[model samples]
Target chain A: MKKLLATILILSLVLTMAVGCTSDKVEETKSLKVTSGLWSRPEEQQFIREEILPGFEEEFNVKVELEVIDNIEKVMEAQKASDEWTTDVVMTHSGTMPLYIANEYVQPLDSVKDSLDITFMDAFESATTQDGKTYYLPISADVYLLIANQKALPYLPDGADVTKLTWEEYKDWAINIADAEGAKVSFPLMPIKASQYQVGGIGLSYGSEFPMINSPGMLSAWELLGEMVKNNAILETSFNYDNPVEQMKSEEAWLTFYHMVPVGDIYSSAPAKYVVAAAPAGPNGNGSIAGAWGVGITAGTNNKDVAEEFIKYLARPEVLYEVAAGTGGFIPPVNEVIAQLGEEPKDIIMKKGLDTLENGVVSGVPASEYTDWGAVKSVFDTVFQEMWDNDGELAKDFLDAQQKELEKLEK
Target chain B: MKNKYKKWFPYFLLTPALLYYVLFWIRPVLRAFFESMTDYDGSFSLMFFSKVINESMFTAALRNSLLFALISVMLQFTVAFMMALLLNKKFKGSNLLLFVALIPMAVPPAAVAILWKTGFSTFGWINNLLITLNLIKEPILWMTAKGYNALLFLILIDTWTVLPSVMIILLAGLQNLNKEYEEAGLIFGASRFQIIKDIIMPILKPTIITAVILRMIAAMQVWMISVMMFGYGRVPFLVERIAYYTDMVPMLKESYKMSLTYSVVVTTIVMISVMIYLRVNKKKEKEVRI
Candidate 1:
């Protein structure tokens, strides 16, 4: 009986120790909850795991529990419903920051602006609200560009100048190259349905000229896409970045308009297969829309100080360059970081595309103006798809109908 | 006192379930009804319902939802009945076939949507096969058309996913039926079709009605498939529109109004269906006595 009692006592002590050890470890980890859309990709995950997390741990002595949310709206809903704002940081599209600001879901970083040495003065000048408060750090600038298969270049008209070609010249060159190679050129037709990235690019291109679709420049943009569809020059496939990259590798497509960042990966993987070039100038000159993905601290986070420090760490020039260059396709949003990354072959190509964004226009429309752009995209997608079916005239009618419906919201 | 204690024991045992129903289901439904009358966005308000009712999109969504529910349920029931009949027979690999039929139900809706998307793409297997067989010289744009085409695709996918559940319910109903009646018909020189039409179907009426009611209730909230395939407010359905209004509109009153409208319509339809089933069963019982 005494022996059994001793065994029980020993077992209980051992169990207590194990539990205590685990609890101690959990406490030491200091799991800072970071909510972001950035860590979704495998490459981005690696960068976080290898570089960002280590640097952050060494500086702040806190372990971050990064929750990579797939949908930004869902994250915001969760944050709002919970009220406590459990997440410490959020990374999302710059287009979406204004809605968060309007809703009071996010706190302004005005308090920590100076200590962090963040160039908030300039960054705020560009991305701040009318009330003079900055909400997000502009991290990487995603610009859409025309990428070409090097094999098709030989078939282009002599002195064709693919980079600066007029819309007509570009079309002619694509048709000529496609005919000679017996392969089609592909452009994302109504890509908003598949990915917001493509839609942003197309919207930017259109918005640059018209700012709103009613203008003549917007009409010409539509006409160009319609003409491309009619000519069979552009393949009516979802212009997924990966799809075009694969097509270029297999030589199935001679050229395609795509985002510049993902093209770097394609270049690295198949160096001999493809080359990158700027999107041929639109009618309003070479206007490309710029998409910036950035990080922001949540409003009610307990670790606001650490979160702000992490943001600074992420925004550091070297870290930005490493993420942009090491990950292959991404162009650092910071001009100095992009310049510091230096002029390697891929860097030079990315720099040429980045240069366009420096002068390029972005949608200056605040997020509050469009709360349900996803729903709007759905409406536009149906219209665009229908237009593709009914010889493109239907698009204008659909757009007009959509504008009427959208105008109700503005009212 | 002892007798009273015994009587109160059952109520005590039932309290948890009754409380659960009140808290989780009944209260929300009542709140939804109240909000539906007012224009509550997602908060307290009274003017939103008027705006919702005034919107053309609401009417269009209601019409589309009714049509989708009616057409999808009828088609799904028919297909499920045929599948249940086939599975009822004792053939080799019959269980395997039933298992395979249930695969769509096992697959997540999001995954199924993506799979269907790939299959429906221009360079997808279906188009490739059609081209190989010279069925069409050009690839058919399956998802691009307005009206019936998009709705039809959604219906087809919904039916495919829900058919297994319907089949299982019907199959159980089929098993519960006495084979003696069908044998009596066969013995009396009734053909197989006559046995099914005259004997089996009438007896199976209550089960079939129950299945139809269940399917209709399920189909009325068919937002996921619609949103996944056609997107919100594009080929709008009642539930999808409610989701849109809730997510898109900042006004709490408007969102609540739309949601309330959806609940009322769905609940009314379900109650009516149950009432009709009860009425029909009563009539059948009266006829038997007569």
Candidate 2:
């Protein structure tokens, strides 16, 4: 009995280990493998699987398998040298699109582009095209917005419209709230949350380009943020805050700036309890980062025709609207969808984002310009830390010193 | 033929383990070493090593990792030893105490981090409790800790989560300890502290060494709790840098090489640390023998 038990245990262990070593066999069915970094939430995935892909699957008589990966570019990069292409189509964001195009991990979608009769917005068109070739077709655009609890309405600066407040007015508003209550104004300062975009948005409002590390406008932006920090206007827990929705829900933070989806999440839950508006303007204009997610075919895909068909299907006006609605609230880049938008709560939120994009000084994805955007984000994080550490008082040469660091990264 | 088969059966049993190690362990280490030494384009290059050395956070990560290992291991061993000794003694409700003490061992590192993170936030439960107790007029900004303060905060949280595991190991050792050795010390009129110092400790040396070495290695690789609590850059560690390279920016051509180099560096450090510790332990053993 002892010997039998030992043999069984060893056999079970070996079998478990062998399971991982076995290669998955390729299936012979008519299938489309779509790897997406967007719409990854469980509910969103369910909606895509049940609501969106069934129509395509039924029409083409193919099994549309949707796999949501957080960093599809890294996966594609790993698979770049391999000939066994597992992914037929990729849906990823604008920041990662540059890497795919530069590495040629994705194929040029010019044929798909020429096939479509619809007109894409000029900015979206320019973003998707590189050296006269369209790499991906833009699906939807998203921008950050200001979300405030209704309790904070009383604390708005005198004569300051919540929608049209300038940076100085916004700072004063924060200061006013901090004085009456605890520090409640927050930003998602955690590294993983792409908080650098928020900093760049402020810098753009101050008349600098996105990721202009040592630009004079960036200096002013930093100084403004430093002043807020000095006044204890920013939440002390912002460093741990990757998303302010929970804080808002807990009433730990009453005012914040965050991505449209999370903001939509807050508003959609309790529309009467919160106010959503366009991000505040700076001296130049209401500067905001306009990010878009696009769909493209991987370079090594065997099913190019199917991938192209999938992209075209994703581009339909109604299809785009459904995607925007299904994946929370993102502004569709198509003109017809924007023109035909309704008065629903989510539509209002997307309209606010579009309002900022139309009226603000819009910056393209900063990663598009830099070879190492992570390094750029590091610079911002370091400066933010220094600003916080010093009670928001920057040394005269601090920005310049950080600029030298940025230059080193560029080299 | 049956005698030969019986003689070779032991070797046959070892074959599976040997193959597992060669395939899963040796292969990855060899691959990482090879990858770290080569350039992206496959040329032999020391550029990655140079970059890692000159990297701004490299020194800080090294210092923090070493300091965390040293401090946390020493602290954990001392507290866990006391708990083990206490639990070894017969007392009422001792089993309940042991059960409560072992509760934290069941919580995973990630969950431990979240539990403490929520507690340590500015307006979190800790502050709320303090406020409710009338201990302060306002909430303290526990999350704003920087430099050594942040390191110490992580150490405290790490200690709370890992203390139970270390104590349980020590408790097992103490339970297995021979009673006659302590009885002999007691008959000689030796005090409790002296009995523990002279008799119990020397006998439990092997077990203590095992527990300390295990805890020290884990402490050296501490990254998850720090990252989960403070994010990437705030509380940088050697393994955290590896994660940053591989997880944060794997798309960069240089990130893979940099992470592999960091892995090599970390492995070298851990190996050297364990070797030095064993050498010291051997020297101490020799001294006692002399």
True interface contacts reproduced by each model, as a fraction?
0.08, 0.56
Q: Clash number for every model?
A: 12, 0
What's the alpha carbon RMSD for model 2?
A: 6.2
Distance (Å) between predicted and true CA of B257, model 1?
Answer: 3.3
How do all models score by TM-score?
Answer: 0.79, 0.85
Please tell me how candidate 1 rates in CAPRI terms.
Answer: incorrect
Residue-level lDDT tens digits of model 1 in B43-147: 556455556567767777777777888899899989998888889887999989988988887887777776776677656678889999999997786755457
Q: Distance (Å) between predicted and true CA of A397, model 2?
A: 4.2
Best by lDDT: 2
Q: What share of the true interface contacts does candidate 1 keep?
A: 0.08
Estimate, for each residue in A190-281, the C-alpha lDDT of model 1 and write its tens digit.
33333333433444554433124434555555566556556666654433322465455545466876667556766667666676677666
Worst 10 residues of 2 chain B by lDDT: B247-256
* Model 1 / residue A232 / CA error / Å: 5.7
lDDT against true structure, model 1? 0.67
